[model samples]
Target: MPAEVDLKRYSKRFANLKSKKETPLTARIQIVGIGDDGLDGLTGQARQLIKNATVLVGPSLLLDKIGNTDSKRIVVGSNLQQLQQAIKELGDSSAVVLASGDPLFYGIARYLTETFGKDRFEVIPHVSSMQLAFARVKESWDDAYLTNLATQPLDRVVDNIRTAELVGLFTTESITPAVVAEALLDRRIDYFTGYVCENLGTPDETVTQGDLQSIRTQSFGSMNVMVLVRRHGAADRPSGSAQRRLFGNPDDLFLQSRPKRGLLTPSEVRCIALAELSLTPTSVVWDVGAGSGSLAIEAAAIANKGKVFAIEMDAEDFALMIENAKMFDVPSLVPIHGQAPEAWKELPDANAIFVGGSGRIVPELVSSAIKRLTSGGRIVVNVSSPDNLVAVQQVLGDAAMQPDVRMINIARGQYQLDRVRFASLNPTFLVLGQK
Candidate 1:
């Protein structure tokens, strides 16, 4: 019994020693997130850390808010390299680096941690101004696209805002809320309700709510966070430029049902399908299973003098298709809200047909659709599964159409954490046949 007790004790001691060696010690350099309200906004622990800090580092504005601290101060400026050197000179001294809002959220902590490994510094975050802005407007930000105008360009930011359902931006002195609002209006993106929260967490805090047009003309304080919430059921407007392309518009430009977003034919696939159709200026085109009218609208733009029918079965998707067609301003595009074969009974014979969907009945739909294709006209079928690919090929073969098959594999490049990553779309197969 005594031997067993001794063995357990020894094992416990060894485990403790192993854990100590494995666990990294808390860093001496503390990066604390502070607000405009300064010391009063800090937690007790954060306040004590600042009070006991041997050296303090922050912007001149933030250092001014520290009042009379005995700790040595180093002011941060545009040159971050100098700040890094100052922090490095502190060596073994206990130092506190102050930042605005959450230190890790587009703040200096990322730079500091990258310069001198994460193990050398501990970060304590406060409520971000962006969070306060959303809270003031009573909106949830978990899914909001948050960015900083200080770090990213305004044009790129406005482009991203075009498709986002919700957006939060940290407005800089130069790129204030009014400036951002103006830029958005310049792009004709006026669907969102804008809110500018200024001097958050301070006595002089103000929250201004208005439309993008009103916000554009109004002046705001330098310190502000802008929040934009897209209006419900509002379709994104097409680009206001007259130089817009006739065909192959970007997939995002169309309004698709949220749950059925991926149902729309990708731009690359749509371009290939449209090309295969060999549409004439006055060709009658049918886009069967057109979820959001992406292909139908583009076809209408190409066949300006002709008619394009977008047939969709789902009621919600049909409504979305109508909205999308209007947004694209394709007057020649007509939406038919019913299943195939029956839907096209009253319609004219099509010069070109594009069949797109992943249903098991796609083979049957394609077979029926080809019957409506005029002699010497083209038909293109887009399918994702190999089974459907073979089935469609067989149907075309039975009609002696001699289908030409092509598989499309696309990978779009995405920028993440200063690196380019490729996100691949599911491979799609296009089977083209001419009557």
Candidate 2:
């Protein structure tokens, strides 16, 4: 039969079938995932769903690749609202949405599930292109940071990539692999090996590997995934975000209320406190009494992959910490407004903890936090008074191994009209213990 004749016959058959069926059929939606293998790769269930679908919706590439199924096809254009309207018009007809790879991982299924309820979709997920990209690069992506350029912009994704060991990105034609390489080099991040995997799961699949400078001029196909593997022994970024320090950032650089500025942990003390905790790239940390979030923000930067909870009871301090965290551009820092012991009830066990305060209750907070620390976990406490020092030391020393104690006395330089002056901050005591 001629191709046009077959299409006409199928359309007539579909019209007659629709007339016979009841109006508004409550058919289940089949969100099917396909790869480069096309229809041959689909499971028996997925194949049947696509074959019997009353209506089909998907990207143009997928529709072209799937060939002819004779179903009422609707191309999902760049405008998602149009697709939503089409699906709404379909009523409850069988909708077999053709998608590539696992639709849930940065795919169309998220939007569909959101637009229509989850109960409407029966998603058949396939091997994600991200997984294939990592497998081709022979890297473990369990700890790798994964994101998509189609939804998330480069700036937001790049910040999270600073401290990541491995990064897998879904690249678009406009924001190609080369664009990402240039962005990384522009930020002075030169310690990663970039790989571009194109036409994944197909016979023409290719993986290109190079440094940022080498990949800067290359253009890749529209369908590609970019992977970045950080070179061993390389720091997250050279100077910690253009002008800020990775940790122990100056107290004044943070956004703080005038009266609480003096109460916040000093840069000198934070430096020592951070060093005592012995942070790693993926360590769960907690900052009790996280005033202005100075300590919590630094911890979040160091442990970018891990979670950091800044537990502060004071409403003013909690609010200040949130603002300061944003100022520092640390996304992993979570501000908890409630008091500790209770606030930390639902939090994960901490690999490192920092407690800052000079009140008599500092000892009690330290004791409670120590109880929640993981084995071999370290805790650092900073106090300004002898009474707090003695009390915290006693409490920590009793619950942990013998504590390491230090007294930090800091001074800053000042020059006015060819004259030099030295200003001194109040002395503080740092007590560190390992559980």
Candidate 3:
């Protein structure tokens, strides 16, 4: 049959179907993921679904690749609104929508499901190009950070790449592997081995591997996936101190002990706690329970000319704190390797103190530390539980110091497969009082 004859027959049937007054049965839309290999890449069940579909819908590129089909075809472009209207006009016709790779992973399936409803469509996924790219490079993607350039800003993606161990990116024509490589180098992030997999699952498939500097100088096919693997044991290179802020640096910049990485106070919470302390250039500060010395190091940076002592009971954490202080070049920061109170017994009274820990003895520690606080100095205690918050508040109340209490709830935005989602941090309670 001629292509025009098929279109006319399809149009007339669609018109007659739409003119009926009675509502038709719910449309069955099968969204099938295809690769560059076209029908050859599809499974038996997926190919059968396409053959049985009464109406076919997809972008021109994908529709062109499918060749001849008995189903009536609707060519969709970037205009999704038109696609939705066309699907609606089908009026209960079984339609098959073709997409590239795994439609759910940064593909069109999410848009279709969101536009219609979950019950209206069934999704059959093919191997995503990201997965193929990782496979080509012989790397695991389970823990890799994956995202699309179409949805996220390049600068934000570069920042995220700075701290990630592995990354898989869906590249657009305008934002190719070369463009991403340039952005990373501009930010002084040069520890990754880059791989650009092009035309995956096809006869013309090619995988290009190079360093960021080399990748930045080369061009690649529009259909490509960019994968970055951090070089083994490569530590993150810090930006020049002149460009760094006095406080609120990214948490990744600090070296943290494994298995207890969450022990460090989050950067957002650290900023708030530091503000509450209100230290001066010449003020003395103490960080009690300073796991990894995040708070004490930032404090030393703020009080550049002042002394900041970080007290930790864990030997490993204490060593990490010392290394972190050196990493940030904060000569004024001191690491005390002992339990608090006893650790600070020989040190001078501090103008500001930050206590961060949980347990029944936290309140007692706060009570004892306050006596060593200089007159007119502030003490800020950060606890994760309500019980500790109340206990610390009661201790301040007994010392005749009215404490200002705050509960901080923080949620950070992170890129998932296709979109950005918020991940909430554990809530923290901060109690600040003056001696």
- Among the numbered candidates, top lDDT falls to 3
Global fold similarity of model 3 (TM-score)? 0.73
| TM-score against native, each model | 0.79, 0.56, 0.73
**Model 2's lDDT to the true fold?**
0.82
Off by over 4 Å in 1: 1-27, 252-263, 278-284, 290-293, 300-339, 346-348, 358-364, 374-377, 383-411, 414-435
RMSD of each: 6.4, 19.1, 9.5
Best by TM-score: 1
lDDT of each: 0.87, 0.82, 0.88
Q: By TM-score, rank the candidates, best first.
A: 1, 3, 2
Once model 1 is optimally superposed onto the true structure by TM-score, how far is the C-alpha of residue 343 displaced, in angstroms?
4.1
For candidate 2, write residues 164-242 as lDDT tens digits: 6789998887898899988888866788999999988888899999999999898888879999998875633423344
Give lDDT: candidate 2, residue 16. Answer: 97
Worst 10 residues of 3 by lDDT: 235-244
